[model samples]
Target: MATNDYTAILNELKGEITNMVVSSASAYADAAKHDAQALLSDMDANLQTWTQQLATGEISAQDLAFLVKTQKDLMKMQALKQAGLSAIAVDKLKNDVINVITSTIIGKI
Candidate 1:
């Protein structure tokens, strides 16, 4: 059996996260934008699996949120770190990304 394609939903999430990072860190827009893409890229495989599970009713919204939050520990956002964004700023950006992920996931359902 073929798995359902989730490219559109993932793309939508990527666009939202990229836009949010660029706007939220105007001073480091370029670096932040790159970070956003990298973060999404790192999460790509898990996202595909989770999104598919969510769509198939194999995972709850809460499960998706929790799973995503757990991935935060793995998010380095190297560009943001190298660009001298404060720890607080990086944390905020991570939170924003999580929010975007959750919101985007739910909105698509």
Candidate 2:
């Protein structure tokens, strides 16, 4: 093949790869946001249930113990969810997408 043909093919492949990487990054961001929101909703529901139980005086000593344990579990889950949404991996993926986009633009220039 000619040199120009080879270069064109390479350019096309690079553009395709860049689009795919950007789309994947967007998908990751969307999924992470959804997971974080779901966790928050779960926490809110748990709080409501706990509040109602307390208001009803249905919380005996054993119930209080269980509620404390549940609270700790929810706190741990919230921390994990937050970490997952803002983790190093997500940051790296974001950087990679940005780098790919920049490279593609510069390459075209």
Candidate 3:
């Protein structure tokens, strides 16, 4: 079996995640800007720890999936809170975000 150099994978994943978050934030409304910025800041704080864990073999794809899910949930909730979106509308938007993130991350690996 060919051993994958997960350090490189993790690094690429991190960059992709950062890009996704930044682009999403850029599209936020003025009222939701603070929440989006906060989300990015939080992600930045954890990026180093996450990359280190993955590089050291302390985490796996499943862990990354969970992280991505949680991040998506938090981001959508924050946006909803700011936007006062209807439940149905929030669900639709959340699903879209989740799908995009999942596909982007998985496609990279």
Which candidate has the highest lDDT of all?
1
Whole-model Cα lDDT of every candidate shown, in order: 0.77, 0.72, 0.67
- Flag the better candidate by lDDT, 2 or 3: 2
Tell me the alpha-carbon RMSD of every candidate: 24.0, 6.9, 23.0
Question: Which digits, one per residue and each the tens of the lDDT, describe model 1 over residues 4-39?
Answer: 336777777789888877776775667667778877
Give candidate 1's TM-score. Answer: 0.40
Against the hidden reference, what TM-scores do the models get? Answer: 0.40, 0.57, 0.43
Arrange candidates by TM-score, highest first: which order? 2, 3, 1
Maximum-TM-score candidate: 2
lDDT of 3 at 68: 71
Clashing residue pairs in candidate 2 (N, C-alpha, C atoms within 3 angstroms): none
C-alpha lDDT of residue 57 in model 1: 100
Task: Kindly report the root-mean-square deviation of model 2 from the true structure over all alpha carbons.
Answer: 6.9
> Which candidate, 2 or 3, would have the higher TM-score against the true structure?
2
TM-score of model 2 vs. true structure: 0.57
